[model samples]
Target: MIDKLAWIRIENGAILTARSHNRDTYYIPGGKREPGESDHEALLREIKEELSVDLILETVHLVGQFEAQAHGKPAGTLVRMRCYAADYHGQLAPAAEIEEMVWLTYADRAKVSAVAQLIFDSIHQAGLLK
Candidate 1:
């Protein structure tokens, strides 16, 4: 199983997502935790690396944890995603391996990764996303 962390940033009723270079599907920003790193530390570092923004640690909160079949992996591989909601400083922009940054809504579900689709469902249901 692959374990990952994601930053859930919602603005104007849309969620922040990113598409890596040469990739077709968009995914929530954040990445795997490094050895000895806590969730918040990893998330902060990953987001800054991917999005070029500093996450406001004081505003961080757990959104949810989701598990699903890992996308594009061999059968039997699973991914456990721990998601968090947090405020950030600085403008959002694509960086590192990211080629594009997008704000996605429910209508754009088909353009995201499976795990992101599930995150959208939960956020939409809670009226946190439109």
Candidate 2:
């Protein structure tokens, strides 16, 4: 199982996301699972590593599961993204290999990952975004 954790942070009603330096599309602030880490732990660690912010675990709200073909990989290279909404501390800026950070609305779906687009669709259907 290719597991991953995604942080769905809603700021001023817009979702805070990042675009990898190597990819054209944006993605949720997240990463692949680490050894023996739970979903929440992985999310916290990834958020900290990528954004240099400590995510409040208690504030992290589970959104839903998103499964899609992993971008830039083979057709069968699927990913299961477990998403969440959360509050965090410190200013969010690009770290590691991230190229840019953007607050995106549902209208920018085409600029995000395939699985991220699915999450955007669901968020729109639920009346959470435009």
Scored by TM-score, the top model is 1
Residues 17-84 of candidate 2: C-alpha lDDT, one tens digit per residue: 89878778899899987788888898898888888899998888889999999888887988899998
lDDT of each: 0.93, 0.86
Residues 1-130, candidate 1, lDDT per residue (tens digit)?
Answer: 8999999989999999999999999999999999999999999999999999999999999999988878889888988899999998998888999999999999999898778888999999999888
Q: What are the clashing pairs of model 1? A: none
For model 2, what is the error of residue 92's alpha carbon versus the real structure, in angstroms, after optimal superposition? Answer: 0.8
lDDT of 2: 0.86
| Candidate 1 similarity to native, TM-score | 0.97
True-structure RMSD, every candidate: 0.7, 1.2
